[model samples]
Target: MLSNGHAHWTGDDPKQVYAICVASLAPVVVDHPQSLVVGKGDPATLLCAAQGNPHPAITWLRDGTPVSTSQDDPHSHRMLLPDGSLFILATRMNKKESDAGTYTCLASNTHGSARSTSATITIATLHSQFVVVPVNVSVTSGQHAEMSCVPPRGNPPPTLSWLRNGHTITPNNRVLVRQDGTLIISEVLQTDEGEYVCVATNPAGIRRSAPAILDVIVAPFWVKAPRDVAGVVGGRAELKCRVGGEPPPTVTWRRAGGQVPVGRARVVKGRGLLLEPLTPQDAGVYLCTAANTAATITANATITVLSPPRMVDMPGDVEVEEGQRLFLRCTVEGLPPPLVYWAKEGSQAVLPAGITTTEQVYLSHSEVAKAGAVGGTKAQYEVATAGRSDSGHYVCGGINSAGGVMARVTVHVRPTLPLPPPIIAVPPTNQTLPVGVAATLRCLVESAAGVGVGHQPAVRVSWTHNGHPLTNSPRHHIRADGTLTIKG
Candidate 1:
């Protein structure tokens, strides 16, 4: 007999008959194809292996479609090897017919058929040119600098790096390479100036950007600063300032808190600021500024205009009655602000005895005093509740290194006079009334003013009934203006 294309003989005698039997089994994959990545125009291979009762036949499929092997078409680039592997002579990069996709192998025999796990095929490529490139840039020393780059499209996205004058730049605290492929220098120095190039690299190839030039400029600095100057009124003054920088800087002059004097002030080309016939208003802080493309610098100097101390507001004579307040005012103006003091006549010592003198008389420097005109210091001497003994000749004096000034103020304290007594101008008249009727009386008194310069004398009125002083009661009402009323 014959079964499954194999011969088997059986007979009555066991020693005369011979039989051969073989078992059938479905195919099982032992090795599946592996994923692979290859450059365009490069060779690739996908491997598969299986075991079964009958020797299995192997075939390949790409993206769920059967692949054409060299046996089916001799001109095809893909071939099936005897060892159940797929070989490609050359990979194609065409958009529609590319040799890159998912692939799998099928193994079959008379018993059954088996399929293998999918494997992926990838093609790597990199463009030749960059999308964005670095360019020339100019910045001052100690300023920020940046260069941007966008690498070409590539498989596995390219990495970016920077090269300065053909040498790789290592990232440090000041130099950094950002995630977006930008090179940044936090504070650029003079040595950082050079030609820069951007490099892009990937599995396929490396691409370099065009060279970019970086220029570092020097900022303006002071070579010689102006010095403090002292000038008398109607005298000339000059101030000089010198500067240095890579690019020539421009020099200008200005008053710190005010504008430079327009007519009297002049700027010399190589020299500095010049002022002819200076005035008292020219005394202030002056600034010399030097500016360039890189930065701006400034220096200041004080201009002091000297003038002697003179009285702007003079104190005059004052008179007051006993127990009255008195004040004397004196204001003086001078350069450096003269110190002010008050003293009584025939005394060289400062007034109020033993206390230090200041710009404000008898008041602490921080105390608020009466405001005087601009450039003038005001001094006031106050006497609270004066008496006859307080009368004297007071002098207000101001002194500074420039000169000294003095002004006298006479003060008189007159004695207070006594107030005259009140006299009865109209006497009360007699009134007679019957029972349950009211009686009215009228009284008027007058008083004379005091002889001194003070308040007037006050008069008070009262009534006596039968030698007894009358007061307010339910029956008797006293008005505020000294009027009396009786209720019946």
Candidate 2:
């Protein structure tokens, strides 16, 4: 036989509970509280303490588990000596997880176990970031360019885009998108440079990286070489034009004043418009025009060619020994080839009989050879075995092809010979004598009359004292002894 049990129990004796609680109860307190603030890489401390009737034993636990001391693990935690307060020694904690938890302190003794409130332990990752951008980037007028966008960090990585004047950039044949969120542009024209923005996006939020300015640096076009040109009267010069740009700059040369013909100009490739054998007609400002990719540029330069060259050193009359070579040097300077003609005084230069003349030519020795020689330009001429008859004035006249005078020089030569000195006689023969003392000196021309000094007059007699010229006085006169005397 089975019987179901259903019974009603009465409350325990209230007096019996009061006697059990009185046997096991202790007061709890915190003497030194723990709170800390530290940098990401630095260490921190959490102090939890209490005082009781009986000395209490303290223990530290993180997230309800005991902290272990392991040097190998970077996220490990531990406590060393001085147990009452917990020491969270030197360590790194991941901010995302594993490091975010509560730490509790439990103090136990004979009175009973009294647990303190829990505290949190967090490991913050370091935050250090910056940005970079390009200042000035230039390309040719009709070339290509690329823009870039970069960021320090992002959760799902950043998506890069370009904005021009606050508007999104769409790709075309001229625009290209890169994996690193950079923009590649083809045929970057001069107008492309200005203000632009780099946009970076992620699920967290859309962040614009920085502002980048595009500067389409274009090379100069139709550029003239020199700023100014100066020349003398009746001379000629030229101006140069060089260009820079894409699609190859096409150069066209023009004169400033009017459409003057490019006369006597020899054009050489690359160097510039060359004007040889220049004249006054070639003086003026010149314009150079250049075109590239439907764009045009112009540059101007002034040029002035100088007139007939003035003789820095003039040619004049001169005398030389009869047997010596007579040099008739005449310097005539002028721009272009000046016609140089040599002639004698009072008559046109006539070649000596049996001596033939080379074709009339202009000579420029140091620099390039002149254009001459009847058929072509030859720059040399010479005459040899000169005689006394050859003594006369010679002329070098420079004339332009326009028959205008450029420069002229005249030279005159006289033949002579060195003379042997005249004989001399002296009454006294003693060698040394003081200056200003009376002395007799004599000279005679019995044998060497025709001999002269420096091929001039006669042997000269001079009196000098201390390297100074001394004049003849009544006391100091030429004596019959041919000696100069001073009466001292």
Candidate 3:
């Protein structure tokens, strides 16, 4: 009998018949094959798993074509494992066969058939030689160094690394590797010189590039340096400097902060710098430079030129009034600044005036006053008040280690004289005047002696009658010489 779409047996005849009922289900993939990149002559495997009511059978397809299994072809390099996986004995790429393509797995049973996600199989390969390789390099110590290389081509791109002298190199603070497979070293030292090789690694294998060499050179250094020299004008001076280096350094000379005198200064091959006929302008700092391919070095020396004392400014003759201020200037120039002194001519006594090494003094009418020196180059002699005793030839002398120089200046002081009252040498004599009769009065005047004519005061005489002044009219007449006449 059939009940609810299920079969049920109720009678048994001779022998019993049994029926087994099971649920029907469609195939479902549990595990899918993964993509793979296998090197040449290397084994590889791809997995596929499924579950269904009828226990689905597994198979693989390559580019829509069923793959031949080991059971189907005894000599086949591909095998179907019992766990529903595909295994390749040895991957290859040749005219006869190539195991490089897209692959998929199919599981099927009586209920239904199902397909898995597609997967690609690629044959891995790597070139034997590098595309770009490092070459020999030469550099100076404390300089930057660089080496670059491009890895070989492969199915999966190869990674890059570096080796030095057959030992692996690890990047540090001063050494680094760029993303483009370049090695960089900052401030390279002598120890960094070695054989360098680029290493390329991939699934196929590891490939090494040709060896490259690195050479480091030493910098120039001073073996002997120059020293300060003292020279005199119209004399010769020499400064020596010696240097050593790996490549033989070249030496040169120059003046610091100024140009060397072209005809007076030159560089001597074996002895060093030579300066002839030295002048005041040539006294300064000089430099000697030694240079090489690696580095440059310099040595310095100072030249001190001595010269005799000379007067740059001298006082001139002057005439001043008595009781007036007087000033005299004298300036001297020399290497070691000279001391200036003032003295009067024909006098053994030197006035404590002018610039001294420590102080300066000014000569007053009666005494000497001390003061500070002025500007180290100029000297001054000052007199607060001029007197007749100060009128004489004054000498200014400058003395230094080199020599001495002197100059003379004359000064005259006029006396301040007092004017005497007008003297009545001849006064008007007693005279008698009468009406209708002419009377004459005479008056004489004289000015003090030694008074200049242009500076004399005006003198005038007047006549008075009973303390009253007289006028020049018809009754009284006055002459140009102070003679008065009266007419009635």
RMSD of each: 30.2, 29.5, 36.1
- Give the lDDT ranking, best first: 1, 3, 2
Model 3 superposed RMSD (Cα)? 36.1
Span of 10 residues, lowest total lDDT, candidate 2: 371-380
Cα displacement (Å) at residue 61, model 1 = 0.8
Instruction: Summarize candidate 2's per-residue lDDT along 59-142 as a digit string, tens digits.
Output: 767788865544334556655335466665554555543433576777777887777777765543321231444334557656
Give TM-scores for every candidate, taking all chains together and pairing residue i with residue i.
0.37, 0.25, 0.41
lDDT score at residue 483, model 2, on the 0-100 scale:
64
Q: Write the per-residue lDDT of candidate 1 for residues 209-322, one digit (tens) a residue.
A: 999978766765554578899886678788888766678888888898789999999987664898888877777789999888777878899887765567777857889998
- Position 469, candidate 1: lDDT: 93
* Regions more than 4 Å wrong, model 2: 1-253, 260-280, 289-296, 301-327, 336-488
Is 2 or 3 the stronger prediction by lDDT? 3
Question: Against the correct fold, how does model 1 do in TM-score?
Answer: 0.37
Q: Which candidate number maximizes TM-score?
A: 3
Candidate 1 vs candidate 2: the lDDT winner is 1
lDDT of 3 by residue, 282-385 (tens): 77899999888877878899987766566667868999887787777786655556687777888897677442222332322211111111212466678877
